[model samples]
Target: MESTTADWVSETRFGKWFLSTETWYREVLSVALREMREIAGPSMPPIRRLLDVGCGQGRSFELLAERFRPREIVAVDIDPLMVRIARDTAGRCAVPVTVMQGSVKKLDLADGSVDAIVCHQLIHHCSQQAQVLSELFRVLAPGGMLLLGESCEEFIDTWSVRWFFRHPPGVQHSADEYVRMVRDAGFGVAPRDIRTSTPWWSLWEFGILRRYGLVRSPLPVTELLLLARKS
Candidate 1:
């Protein structure tokens, strides 16, 4: 089946190469996995059903399964190849994950069916980001949490990423822009719920600054993770 969208990581040779490797699979995704458990902390409801959007290769399967221990995990990805890999890998996990090919703009699940959403590093790739945000709100059960992780254009336009990755034009946004978009979608967000981060890898090509001790303690933050709740 032809995809309704373009510029996905699965479409390009480099994208496939990067995603199929251990470096990008675990190490790259681990930065956001650290926030997953925190998003599913004691404050939130006992997560029963989970959805991992953009769950390529099911790299986050073990982490989400281990942390939330949800009864079921529904993994969704637009790429058919990724969906296949995810389905194949889902069995390795103790938690049951139903892998499906679907776009974030239009999820196939029922309204308010999921207890939590692990939307890591996926939104910037989407052109219809507002529709995707609204869809997240629609699928999440009341009081459900969304662990939204994305890097800003500053990070995306970097030499390392610009060369290897191809994102949808006019889709990238700053941390505050993403926060506002999430808030505008009717999800409740607080100062504490939102988080801004600067991953070392985001500035990997700019290591000369760090090496020269020119980079300050807090390097330029290029990533944003907002934990929004369906109110």
Candidate 2:
């Protein structure tokens, strides 16, 4: 048996707590929705078409619908199983959504087609993060926004994470490095566009220290959210 970087985004992993967990969804969805709104601000243009990279089982379709309300939401995943689930989930949404199975590194979509792109928790899985970043930038229309959320190497190196997940070590990046890559990909990375966080899940990696008052504790840089725009 052998494992590759693609295994990280495989169906078996998606069936696990990584994509199926209720708490994880709540935590990510809360921040993603809020940050996206804040990034777009008041004078934002109407989002007609949106591309959700690594949509994985369509977990984000409902959230995207409620927040951005794109007239057509394109949900994409590397796994076929997830793509099927995404299509089913999108079919159920009030918003017209399309689900496709493809890699962000080389998307089949036309250039500058999507109004916005939501790429979350996906960059680390890419063997070629720059290619994916470039694809994201290419697909976004001028003045379109890109909401990118990812866990840095610091978080991935934690004992709990190292035990449960498999990642390509070479692709991992720190919060600063991740932001730099996005910037180098031609995105407008402002100071305000970059944000780093230690989520509650990361605070107590195993949930062992959360209830104790003895340790208000070592909060690792588990997450980084960057809301960039294509100009």
What's model 2's TM-score?
A: 0.89
- The count of backbone overlaps in candidate 2 is 0
Q: Estimate each model's TM-score.
A: 0.90, 0.89
How do the residues 1-231 of candidate 1 rate in per-residue lDDT, one tens digit apiece? 334345343445677567778777656677577775675567656889999999988988988887777899999998887888889899999988899887888899999999999998898888888889999999999989898889898788777787777677677888999999999998988888777877667886456788778866666669887788887
Q: Model 2: per-residue lDDT, tens digit, 97-169?
A: 8888778888889999999999878888777888889999998999888989898988777676766776666
lDDT of each: 0.82, 0.79
Tell me the deviation in Å of residue 61 in model 1.
Answer: 0.8
Runs in model 2 lying further than 4 Å from the true structure: 1-17, 204-218
Summing lDDT over every window of 10 consecutive residues in candidate 1, give the lowest-scoring window. 1-10
Highest lDDT scorer = 1
Spell out the clash pairs found in candidate 1: none
